[model samples]
Target chain A: MSGSARVLGVLGGMGPLAGATFMQRLTLLTPAERDQDHIPSILWSDPRVPDRTAARLAGGEDPLPWLLRGIAGLEAAGCGAIAIPCNTAHGWFEAMQEATSLPILHIVEAAADELLRLGITNGTVGLMATSGTLAMKLYQGRLAARGYECLVPAEEEMARLVMPAIELVKANRVADSYAPLAEIARRLVERGARAVVLGCTEIPLGIAAGPALPFPVADTIDALARASIAWAKPAG
Target chain B: MSGSARVLGVLGGMGPLAGATFMQRLTLLTPAERDQDHIPSILWSDPRVPDRTAARLAGGEDPLPWLLRGIAGLEAAGCGAIAIPCNTAHGWFEAMQEATSLPILHIVEAAADELLRLGITNGTVGLMATSGTLAMKLYQGRLAARGYECLVPAEEEMARLVMPAIELVKANRVADSYAPLAEIARRLVERGARAVVLGCTEIPLGIAAGPALPFPVADTIDALARASIAWAKPAG
Candidate 1:
């Protein structure tokens, strides 16, 4: 069960697109020849969970029941490792990781490990994600341990900038959604971020590869993709 | 079953990385809430196919047997459409498409469709792919129908340039793979591509928004992703 073919499972649908992005990342990450070399992946992309921000701030319905159902299904199907593609879902992820026997891939741990390997120092990584991810401090908590800092849009910038773009995704207005991000990327450069992590998987959907503002952007989803590939690869 | 989930089943692993890139493109292209909201995808990434270029030149093993099995699996699983990520594999795709009852989303056709939408004409589309894709009429034949002029690397350029990078990928030597592609891209721009299609999905992995490249690059995988999303949306 822990070997090839039945390797990875995902608990997703925090926004469906992030999970979709992560799965796509999985496909690209595997090195294969015909069409069966990929590790078989079972994904539960359930978007019905109550908003994480709402649940944490004001007492709202918990997503635990739905998340556990997703876990049980994947476990029943014999998955070895688990991953949650949502950045905001990390609040529950700690609980989920502890509950599941499967080694869950935490994006925070994955990104931090990559930063360590890259020798990323006092350097600030510009984070672009949801209000929940920013406010909840999922990545911030783990990154603080590794001595790396996470920079985000200020209160005014986040409201006028990031949130609007996320709205465009929820609405499926993809092209229209990108303009605000392009503008915000300009401001983030002026603020001196060494690199930007498209922390939200949906953000990459909006970004076209270009040097609009400053510094290279490392997509956190792409980071997770690389991490997953590393995990899936046969150990030397 | 056809009411939703276009279900683009992929027969891949001329190289697994290529399959992964295609999945990412599919996810990127689909418009959805959680990953499940997009098309249901079943990927069979087989990495044991003979070197496509070598097989084309000499009488060697073919990928047809493997391709058929994967496509059959997709059909049995209720996939509505199928796509293979390898440019080289497209040589046999027409045969595979005919074998399956489901529609096969041709990546070349999809790219041309996007070009028409983008209003690209008169300029050349730089094609970065495996030698087999060029030798066979995989992209050229379909692109001709769509009124696109394809610009592929010269055979000498293919040997001196692109193959080295592909080998690096097989060896797991990433980061170094980008330099060869960068050099090749500059040459293609000088010869005449207005924009380059990282025709091979893996090339985009190499070409991800880096320091402004020598030319404008449109990842076919990106186009594939965007188009698949469009295909999944119920027409308004």
Candidate 2:
């Protein structure tokens, strides 16, 4: 079997579109002049895995076992490392890593690192993600650890704006999601957030470019894609 | 490790976007109300596999070994069946099937089946693909076996329209590709093509849905995605 210099495994299908978005980002991010120069990847898009937010909030089945199986599949396919694009899934990150020796890139950690790299050291970073991600402090804890304050949607805003918006995206009503999500971004900026992190994978799809949302948006999937590329770089 | 009832392995990334598009179509085509109802898939998007067109035409490095490795990776990941999205890569379909005992879905055969289902048994089916696919008679031979005549781009059209359009798509200038490709589609319809198969994965990305081109367009990726879903259905 002729593997590339390195192969990055993608643990995805938290929602199938999000997984596809991650793969598309990988293609867009790479400096490949030709198709053959792009990264080699093995992706396990098993949408059969239980929903992470529902599993955490409503006494649904644990997604860990299914996630572990995905990791195993990637490993079996000879992936050197793995990356999961979903932010809410990181609630079980430690357990998934424990299940396998393969180095798994954390989405929140990658986003936080990207924020610091962009020189946003001391500002309030806004996070717009699934309720489960916010409830578990997925981005909050990671940003706080790096000495950055985090701002999130208020409880009412979450119920009224963020969560429903994510649902709309999952249901393939992406255009309908824009207004509510844009309002959430506006409120976050008003609450003194210097930049916003699209903590949920589907969030980026809803929000479009050009002066609509008046802050720098850091897409977590884009950060993870870059991290995967760096991780796949051959050792010196 | 837990595998789904049936895992369809994707041998992809002859061009990265095409592979992602195939995965997206699988998600779209399934009769799933929730995520878990969708099929599970393992994908090896190894763009590092040498170009199939260059190999066939100009005596470049054979992509067969890299392709075989991808197949092995899929089998190791416990895939019961496999699909390759690239039309040009179908040239090595038999060789890959010989390398693995797992059932592999053929994109050309799936498209041919779709043509019959559409009730276009005796008319000329137009094909728009890379020079390599055209040269190998990839679609022509399969459609002919099924008693359908295949009409490819004329040599002048291949050089002037089809080949350059595919390159523009590969270069991410999809919008620029639309006009030329639509012209080619117009010419094919004028030549008595009852339906046109977007034989190249990149072709569908170029043409838009509107009254510009009037022929029935059968997207090969869509046919392959449906075939994969059928292949993964649990036996009664």
Candidate 3:
């Protein structure tokens, strides 16, 4: 990567809408008086990458090679760093970082860091995401390493509430997501969660930050967007 | 471009949000039941490209080289077709198409084709866009060639209603853009426009397709997105 070029590579399309939402958040987060002041991004939105959740849980094809192709495309285009917005896809983060010298920003790590920044140290954070994300321990492992207790929905709730809500969001029926998601958040709060982390990108699209839930929600997309902005900023 | 590869190159970052929105629309518009079923896209969202409207109207730095670099990046990455989401930047569409053998999809041409598809032939259409788009006669030239009369805001309306609304949208205050734009639509309808073409990408972000406006609105982003989907589809 050239020292003068501050391009951010986005490794996206784990779900195409999540990837695009991340880009939109990045645009809104940047403090730009003019178009030139915003960060330059190389986005390879190849939705052909195999499904992450199905691959983790049900013997679907591995998405690594397709993801690697996207990473290489961005690297070849001279991107200095990379950000992947899909939370479930972080299962391959370490391997992806090893595949390229480009600094890949992890969505889980950013969310964990956000928990620390928000003064929620040593407390329980509720996580709402796909079964694969929980099964892979994407958030649990990171939050545990950071000395924070992670709370998740029980198996019944995961099957009956969380997964269905995520699917609804993927299908673009966001209005139907609010009630089920709010119920899950309320349950997490009853179990002593300080803040609910929207571990899935689709979660934020359906749920708004308001008084309907019992806890403050930390959106992983916003955390990742902030991290990307920081990564693209010029060094003093 | 190779005959086997079905890739879409996006020449974007002329107001990065619009570019991102275009990508999201493309993803939604594609008839994909699974991940790989969607089109492969290479997006170069380089915001440092010189401002198109400013360059056209105020003798500012030219945006063509930066645009060409984006197009070349896509082509080198194995893209078979290219789409640019910016409207004012369409002022250089012919020259850009000449610069590369890759098929370049035109926003105005797409809008005109969409109008015809909607049975809007031989009728007057209203245009709402930036001063640069108007001054360059971007929509009028193409629509006239396609045998349709185009109506633009008068100079006073351009200065008072259209340009300010565009600026507000650029600043991300899209909610405030509704009333003045509705008024413009009504005035254009009174002057004999059968439908309104949202020639600028930002207009759709601000104005919703509803019964409030006197004329039917045609979104250029949707038109371009549809054109891209057609371009990327496998031929029988």
- Tell me the tens digit of each residue's lDDT in model 3 across A153-216: 9999999989888776666566787888888988998899999899998788778623455457
Model-by-model lDDT, in order?
0.67, 0.83, 0.83
The candidate maximizing TM-score is: 3
TM-score of each: 0.63, 0.90, 0.92
Fnat per candidate, as a fraction, reads 0.19, 0.66, 0.63
Q: Comparing candidate 1 with candidate 2, which one achieves the higher lDDT?
A: 2
Model 3, B23: alpha-carbon shift in Å?
A: 1.2
TM-score of 3: 0.92
Q: What's the lDDT of the predicted structure labeled candidate 2?
A: 0.83
Runs in model 2 deviating more than 4 A are A116-121, A208-214, A233-236, B1-4, B116-121, B208-214, B233-236
TM-score of chain B of each: 0.88, 0.94, 0.92
RMSD over all Cα atoms, model 1: 6.8
Docking category of candidate 2: medium
Off by over 4 Å in 3: A1-5, A116-119, A208-214, A234-236, B1-5, B117-119, B208-214, B234-236
DockQ of each model against the real complex?
A: 0.14, 0.56, 0.55
Instruction: Write the number of the candidate with greater TM-score, choosing between 2 and 3.
Output: 3
Residue B123, candidate 1: C-alpha displacement in angstroms: 9.4
TM-scores of the candidates, chain A only:
0.88, 0.95, 0.93
